[model samples]
Target: MKPLFVTGSSPALRLTVALLLSLTLIFVDSRYRHLDFVRSTLSVAFYPIHYLAALPPRLARAVDGRLASEADLRERNSLLERENLELKSLMQTHQALQAENRRLRDLLGSSFKLRDRVMVAELLEVDLDPYRQQVLVDKGASSGIFVGQPVLDANAVMGQVIRTSPLTATVLLITDAAHSLPVQVNRNGLRTVASGSGLINRLTLLHLAKNADVRVGDLLVTSGLGGVFPPGYPVARITEVRDDPGSHFASVIAQPTARLDRSHEVLLVWTLPALSRAGELDERPLDAAPPAGMDTSR
Candidate 1:
C-alpha cells in the first residue's frame, strides 16, 4: 500500500531524519549505556591490520639497534686489546728498571774499595762474533778514553778498551781468546793469569800447578799488576780444578762474575797511577816485572 506523500517533506527532510536517529544512539551511549564491549571487539578485529601496518618500522628499528650494539662491542674490544698491550709494555719497562737499579746499587757498593776513578758509559752496540767477543761503547778518544783502558760492569771485569775513535770505543771482552788478565785467588792470595777461552762464561787459569792452592768456589779478583784493572775488583769464581799429570799445566776453569750479555751500562775506569812530573817511577809496564824489593806497585 502506498503511503500519502506530504507536500513539504523533500529529500533533505529525509536525510535529516536519518541523522537524528544516529544522534539519538550517541546520546543514549553517552548518558547511561556503556559501549566498551563494542570498542574492544572492534579493536580486537583490527589488531592484525594495525600490527601489519607498524611491522616495517619496528623491524627497521630493531636492525638499527642491533647494529649499534655490535659496533659498540667491537670498539670496546679494540680498546681493551690496546690497553692490555700497553699494560704489558709498562710491566716490562718496570722490570727493566728494577734490574737496572739493582746493578747500580752493586756498583756503588764496590766503588768504595776501588782506587780507580770510574766514569759511566752506555753500550752502543754488542758484537759477539764466532771468533771474537767484543762490544762497542759510547765513549772514545774525546772522552779521555785510550787503548788498554779497563771496562767493568756492576759485578766484575767486562773487558778492556782496545780501540778508540772520536766518539766510540771497541771493547775486547775478557772472554775473547786473545784477552788475558792477572788474577788471584781470594782465599790464599795465589796470583795467576786467567786467559780467555773464547767462551763468555769460562776463563782458563793458565799454568796452574798440580798442588795449586786454588779450588772450586774460590773467588778470583784482580791482582792490580797490569796497571789496567784495579785490585779487589772481582773477576771470576773457580768452578773446576783438574790435576792431570799427563798435561804439564793443571786444568782449571773459572766462571766470570759479570753479566756480559745482559748489561747495558759499563764503567770506564782509570786505574793507572798519575805519573810524576819527572816520570821517574811510573807503574810497571805490561811486560815488565816490579822491582825485587818490598814491591811498592800501585
Candidate 2:
C-alpha cells in the first residue's frame, strides 16, 4: 500500500477544504451568474426526469376535468329528456280538452233545437261483448234516468237505456242483434220495422212488400209507434234495396245516422205528452215508463 499511494494531509483538514470550496462556488454562482451556462446544461440533461416527476399531478387534473365534463353532459341530457316528456304530455292533454270542447258545443247546439227536457250524461264504460252493443252512462236512477229512456247523441238517436243502478245505467245500442225500432220513410211516410243486423252500420227492414216504395238514399226516422223512441228523430238511411221476383218481400239495408260507436256523451230525453185529435192531452202513456222496481223519486 505504501508503494502504491502516498498521504500528505489529515482527514479533518481535507473535509474543511471541501466545505470551503463548495461555499465559494455557491456564492459566485448566486452573485455573478457565471455558472449559468453550466446550470442550464444540467437542467436540459435532467428535463425528462423533471417532467416525469410532475406527470402524476398533471394527469390527475386532466382526468378530473374530463370526468367533470362527462357528468355535466349527462345531467343536461337528462334534464332535456324530462322537459320533452312533460311537453308531450301537456300537448296531449290540450288536444283532448279541445276535442271535448267541440263535442260539448255540438251537443249544446242540438239541445237548443229540441222541445223536450234533456240531460247530458257522459259514458262511463263500453261493453266489450261484440254480440251485445251496449254502453254505461254516468247517470242512473239517482239522476232520474230510467229504463227505456231514449239516448241520443248530438247527431241522432244512439240507443235506449235498458238497465239502471243507483249511480249508473246501461244503454242498449240500436246495432245490437236483439234490438229493433219502428221507423218511417221521411219522403212518403212508408212505415216499416228497422231491425238490427248485428252490424254497427247496417239495419234490416223487416217484412217489406216487393212493390214497397222504398229506395236508396231515403231518410228513415222514428215513427213514434214504439213507446221507447220519440217521433221524427233520425234513425237510419236506406242504402240498398233488392227485390227478387220469386220472393214476396224485398231485401232492404240501411245505415244508422247516429254515431253509435263513437259517442262519448249522450242525451237523456223526457219527451212531452202527445195531444189527441181534440187537442187534449191523451191519458194513454205515450212514453215507456221506468221499470216497476226502479226508484225514480229523484
Candidate 3:
C-alpha cells in the first residue's frame, strides 16, 4: 500500500519538492558544518556497497599482474641467452690472447730479433693431398702476402706461401716432400737439409752421414744458409735415428715444430736476407775430412 502511494504521487510535485529540499540543504551546508557530518554519515553507510562495486575491477587487475609477471620472465630468459652467447665470444677471445702472449714469450726467450713484419690470418681450409700437405689462408696479396713468405704458428714454422690472390692464398706446409729447409741441429750446429716426407707430422734430415752428430731429441733450427727463412727459427725435432749397416747413410726422421693438424691462426712473415756485396757467393773455408765410418757418397 505504501509503495502504491509513492508511485501514485504526481511526478512534477515530487521533483519540485526534491529540488527545494536540495537548495535548503546546500544553503545550510555553505553557512554551517552540519552537512559535513551528514556526508560522513552517508559514506559510512555506503562503504559496504562501494567495496562490492570495486571487487570485479580488483580481480581483473590481479589477473593482469600475473600475466605481466610471466611476460617479464620470458623477456628475462631471452636476455640471458643473448648474454650467454656474448660471454662465449669473449671467452674465445681471451683464449686467443693467451695463446698469442705465450708465442711471443717463446720468441723473445730464444733471443730472436724478428725484423719481419707479420700479418695475422686464419687457416680457411686444409688439403691432405697425400702428395702434398697444404692449407689455404684467408689473407691474400692485398694483405701484403706473397709467394715464398714464411708462415708460422705459435710453436714453429708451418709453411711458405706458394700462391696468392687478393682475398686468398695457398700455403705449402713443411711436411710436403717438395718442401725443404736449410736447418742446423741445435745440439752440434751440424747443418743439413730438412725435407718433408709427405706424411703428416713427419720430416726427413737429408744428406746426413751415418756418423752424423744428429740424434733423436735434437732440435733443428733454420740455418739461414739458403737465405729463404730467417735464421734460428724452430723447424723440426729429430724423432728417429736409423744407422743401418747395409745402408750408406743414416735414415733419420723428425717432426715439425708447428701444430700442423690443429693450427687455426698463422702469421705471415716478411723478411728478406741481407744481401752481401760478394755477389751471392761468399768464400768460406771448407771443413776437414769426414769421420772414418762415414760414407762420402751420401
Candidate 4:
C-alpha cells in the first residue's frame, strides 16, 4: 500500500545507520556542551562571509600609507628654496665692501692734507655724456697721467685730465659745458669764474659784478688763478644769488664740491713741476704755475 516512494535504507543498513549517527554526535559534542547552541548559531551565520574575506588587504594598506606621505613633503620643499638665494647674495657683497672702505678713508685724508704729489686714480669710465661731463681714469700715460692734470675727489675739484692713454685717462668733469674754474670767495677773496652748467651738480658764477660780494653760503676756493686747479682746492658751494637790476651780471649758483656723479676714486694732482715731467705737462699752457710747496695763501 505505501509503494508510492518507499525505496529506503539497504546498503548495509545505510552504512550501519551513518556510523551510528556519527558516534552519537561525537559523544554529545565531546561530553555535554550541547553543541554550544549549534556552534554559536553557525558563527552568527557566517559573519558576512568572514568580513568579505578581509576587505582587499585592508584597502591595500591604506593606499600605501598615503603615497608615502606625499613623497616626504616634496623633498623638504626643495631644500628651503636653495638656502634663500644664498643669503641674498651675501648681503649685497657686504654692502659693497663698506662703501669701498669709506672711499679709501676719504682718500687717505686727502693725501694727508696735501702739498701736492698725490696719486690714487681708479674711476675707469663714465662719460655717458649728459653734455659730456667725462671720467675714465685708471691712470694713463703710464700713470703720470697729464693733459692739464688736476682731477681730485675725496671732495673737491673733480676733473681735468682731458685725455691720455698709456692705460687710460679722460676726466674733464667739473660739470662740463666745456668747464671753467678759478673760483675764490672762501668768504671774501671774491674773485670768480666757476662756469660749467652742463650740470652734474651745477656751477656757473662767471663775471659776478652786480655788487658781487656773492653770498649764499659762499666757499668756492681753488682760485690759485687757474693753474689748472690747486689754490686752496674746494670749488663751489654758493648755491644761488640772483640779482637782476636789468642784468649787469650776478646769477651765481655753485654747488659742486665735487663728487660729480659720485666719484669712485681720483686725485692725480702732482700739481705742477710740469706734473713730474709727464712729457713736459703736454706742452704746458693751462694758465700754468702753482705747485712747488703750494699754499697759494687763500
TM-score for each of the candidates: 0.55, 0.54, 0.54, 0.25
Sequence-dependent TM-score of model 4 = 0.25
Best by lDDT: 2
Question: Which rank order by lDDT, best down to worst?
Answer: 2, 1, 3, 4
| Alpha-carbon lDDT, every model | 0.73, 0.74, 0.72, 0.68
lDDT string for model 4 (16-37, tens) is: 9999999998999755656745
Clash count in backbone of candidate 1: 0
User: Against the hidden true structure, what lDDT does model 3 obtain?
Assistant: 0.72
lDDT of 2 by residue, 91-175 (tens): 9998898778778978786422235789999875334467777886767677888667789998888888766665667788787
Q: What overall lDDT, based on C-alpha atoms, would model 4 receive against the true structure?
A: 0.68
Q: Kindly report which residue stretches of model 2 are placed more than 4 angstroms away from their true locations once superposed.
A: 1-114, 275-298
Cα displacement (Å) at residue 125, model 3: 2.9
- The collision pairs in model 1 are none
Q: What RMSD does model 2 have? A: 39.2
Q: Give the TM-score of candidate 3.
A: 0.54
